[model samples]
Target: MILTGDIGKVKTLLALFSQEKEAKEVARREFYNKEYASLQEIISVFLKKNESPLKEEPIFIVCFGIAGPNINGNCQIYEPDKLDWQFTIRELRELLTANYVEVLNDMPALGYAIPKLAESDLVSFNPNVSAEKGNRAVSLATGTGLGELLLYRDRSGDFLPSPSEGGHANFAPRDNWGLEFLTHLYSQFSPPISWEKVISWSGLQSIYGYLKDRKGVKETDAVKNRLNREIPHEVILDMANQNDELCQQSLKCFASLYGAGVGDLALRTLAVNGVYIGGGMVQDILKKEITKHLFIEAFMNAFKDKEGFDKTKNFSKRNAAIPVKAFINQEMVLMGALQRARIMANLD
Candidate 1:
């Protein structure tokens, strides 16, 4: 049996895998923690639930796709509103008692799984923009935090995934509202604000705060109660789906900023093949009417909005025509981790 994990800020995903008599099988579970609990605690709770199966099957390898940079087999995962935590591959191997352990940045893991995705796993945002063959691709995930990665075909005609800290890049405001939003964020946080501050779960909450404080929007009792009880990001989405005016506007703003970030990534990477939008927040929004209209409009328009660069109109046009997709497979990161583990063990 193989153990795979995708550790992030809001949720830690775990999958137990085994080869069945006729096919490969996997069982998945999620651990939600506000503080992004220690890895030992997470694994302990997971093992408690799957004790019987674990006792019967000897785990072969463990692979973890964590939300942060993996430097020299060491990772320092950054959590929103919490201190960064460190994890090393050597320590992980000893703790899990596994023969091998692999740690990778979460976004690159999603990139690794892109080629393996089925047609049903994707929701095309721009069907008219056919993906160019042999071109590069980018994956941007917005969740507890934002993650970005680039994928290009190598000399051997195989896709190679590279992780990036692009999410930490400075946020560029395109309009008056964006400028005001940046000012509001600056008031709340320190200098050098990044896209992660505006496009993540906490980012949504920050947007909501700005809307409420600066725009003087009113939140209904339902929204207030939900905000007090559940995750603010979830609450905002639910309220938006329920047609709450303030929440709707907040979501629209978030969508636009998200689109802008995507456009920037597309331009930076020249990802002509596609730009994949993944993560829990995007998945939630995709289920709502907002994604069909407001989100796509903002995303497409931002990609083509090169008002100041009249000479680079063609570049904007090219970007506008780039294939943008929403990845619906929530297990993509885990699948990628598993695939990488197989590759590492020479089992694939």
Candidate 2:
């Protein structure tokens, strides 16, 4: 069994897999944690619900890919984003009675899925460029928060992934608008603006706030109501799709900020293999037609990865040469956990 999802959402996703003769899913379920007293409760219900047909195959492992960093089998989550209670690996082992239990940071979990990603699973930002093998990086922006990490191949050619606290690193502004946004955030939240402040869910909302409150951009009352009641970024994207100027500008700002951050990751990690953009929010971003162009162009312009003294031509060439893609499949983390579980159980 494997579980993966944002902890802040109080959601549980479980997948049962068999790797004996073939690697495949035997069963799967997704449920809100709020519906049950604990994960143990829903997992018991899930097992009973799917018991009969697959009773012949018994589960031997359970792995979790957590949104926060994991150290010594315990998740070091942000205090404010605590789960109802942290589930210990030992407790999970007892509940499932599995032979092995594993925990992984979400960013690394996302990285582990890169090798298995098919072209169909991606929407390329810089198409027609082949990625050269080296290190790779993943930058994820979810409703929960922002995460970044690195993946490098071992001697055996399997990826060895690591967690990162890079999202909390200071935000680097790109232009006047970026500086203005930084000042706006500083005025509100005070000092040390991080990339998480400009590129994640709250980041998206921050952009909208900058436009509506500071730039004096207009927003309809309906949009305002929707923003309060519905998911903020989703509402913004929907409004942008409907040609709302304020919403459109917010999306554009988000794309550019995201580009700058991804550019930083690619440069810092020297991720010649490629840079992957993933998270729960990707679907919303891709729904608007212009978002891809906005993101791609911004990423290229921000791709100050490397340049020779020749400057202009070299800068353009360097920017255009890097490979970037946004993955829309929401199952990568779960699949990654499954992959890790398989590795733990010696199935691969």
lDDT of 2 by residue, 242-266 (tens): 7788988887778878877787688
Model 1, residue pairs in steric clash: none
User: What clash pairs does model 2 have?
Assistant: none
Worst 10 residues of 1 by lDDT: 19-28
TM-score, every prediction:
0.80, 0.88
Alpha carbon deviation, residue 61, candidate 2 (Å)? 2.0
- What is the Cα root-mean-square deviation between model 1 and the actual structure? 4.0
Candidate 2 weakest lDDT stretch, 10 residues: 1-10
lDDT values of the candidates? 0.79, 0.75
Best by TM-score: 2
RMSD of 2: 3.0
**Tens digit per residue, CA lDDT, model 1, 1-348:** 788998876678898877333226556788875544577678877777888888888677888888777889888777657646777888787778888888888877888788788989988887888877655556465665677888888886767797777888899998999999999999989989988888888888898999998999997888888888798888888777777898888878887788877887887887888888877777887787754566667667766665445655567777777888888887888989887777666665
What does candidate 1 score on TM?
0.80
